[model samples]
Target: MHIKEFFSPDHTRLSFEIFPPNQRMSLKAVMASAARMAAYEPDFMSVTFKADGSGGDQTIQISNAVSEVMGIPSIAHLTCSGIPKTELPAVYDELTENKVKNILVLGGDSTRELGEDAYLPYAKDMVAYFRERGDFTIGAACFPEGNDPALSMDEELRHLKEKVGMGVDFLTTQMFFDNEVFYRFLEKARTMGIDVPILAGIMPITSAGQVRRIKDLSDAALPDSLLRMVDRFKDDPDAMFDAGLTFAENQMADLVAAGVSGIHVYTMNKPAIPERIVRDLGRLFHA
Candidate 1:
């Protein structure tokens, strides 16, 4: 099913993002965990593409299993960083053979040095390519806090408008800890005429290491309240987990109360994370 059809003005939808396991982990084990997550009956599940594109085969396999075997719609991430344009036909054939209907186009971390002729340098390029390639539903990423710290908000919004104009069906945001930041972004996007449904990405930071990684990766604004809680419980594993989960619960509750289009949890391949979220926000999701 096209993910766009899941969005409604009256109801907020729930979705989960899972990644392909590394070489040491067996596909069967990840599928088992996916089965557990599927029991919650989320609107859909998205399988992430590896940064270097080494796990492209596994991504396809997992997405196929999640959709065909688990009986849920799946959005397979297709990255343009390491993959060559010449190789796209085979990948598209695989997705078609597997009956996958949705794709999230991204320009993931480059595994090799790129020159001027790089296949698809930006996510927008891939979105346009996919739109012309087939009849699949396409998704693209957005940054509520701004993807590049150097780019002005006007420049960022201009680029985002161009991307959505290139036939993007919807957008999933990079995770942010503050709802107000997202609200401001939504207002700007609406005012700019980018009216597609935007799913708010929520990542539950269960460990101090994740906090450090988040700081290094994106310009996601972490609230002082959350940082204080993490600093207080960084040394204690159990306490840190509880604090992180509760923080995510409260954040999601606020987003739901505000009637956001949808919530996409970056599961990090952990079923327990979304399990707790579903348990705490049960009525919000059902409402």
Candidate 2:
């Protein structure tokens, strides 16, 4: 299914993301994880652009393999950091040739030596860039917390409206733990008449040590209730894993009950996490 299609009323969308391995031998493990997660039947899986801008051509092949060979929709994270805008056409060509139609346009990380600090600056530009030329459906990122005091809600909304104005088909968010934060974002978007479907981004932390790493990873707010769980179970790996999954399941349940259009799991390319998440969704979504 297309990424945009995941955001429908009757639909329940769960997605996992993977990074293409640099070595041929490790590809087996990546594929194994992909296949194992496939049993739960995610609506789609996304392949990330590796850090340091080395894997464009390789990521293209892997994304195609997962989408065409595995018979599951795959999203390409096409970042414009190290690569030049003038060179993006070949990237699009590779994706379309493989029949992979969905892409997440990212400004990506910094390429300072290249004298480019913004790294595509805004996703709105990326949305418009490919949209005017092709049959691709694009997804862009949003931060629900709007907590970056550096950027106001109005400013973020302005850019969001710009993306939609430029033909962006859908929006996913940076991970957020507090439902109230998401609700506030939704309400504000509604007030501003920003009607694009927003997929809720949920990152499930399976281990206690992951707490620091996850905090450093996304703009997700750490709720007190969840922090307490992490602190209490930090010593026991088994207990921490169970508690983490349970917390994530509970969060997903709340999002489902509150009528989120879809759910995107940042699986971190680990089967055990998505495996457990999929196992819980059956009862969580219905209960």
Score every model by TM-score: 0.95, 0.90
Q: What is the lDDT of residue 258 in candidate 2?
A: 81
Model 2 TM: 0.90
Off by over 4 Å in 2: 22-25, 51-53, 117-120, 283-287
**Over the stretch 205-277, how does candidate 1's per-residue lDDT look in tens digits?**
8888998889988899888998999999999989998899999989899999999889999988789987888
- Cα RMSD of all models vs. native, in order, equals 1.5, 2.5
Q: Across residues 198-274, which tens digit of lDDT does each residue of candidate 2 receive?
A: 88988876666677876776667788888998889888888888888898888888888887877888876778888
Model 1 residue 124 CA deviation in Å: 1.7
Q: Candidate 2: lDDT of 65?
A: 81
Candidate 2 global lDDT:
0.76
| Span of ten consecutive residues with least summed lDDT in model 2 | 110-119
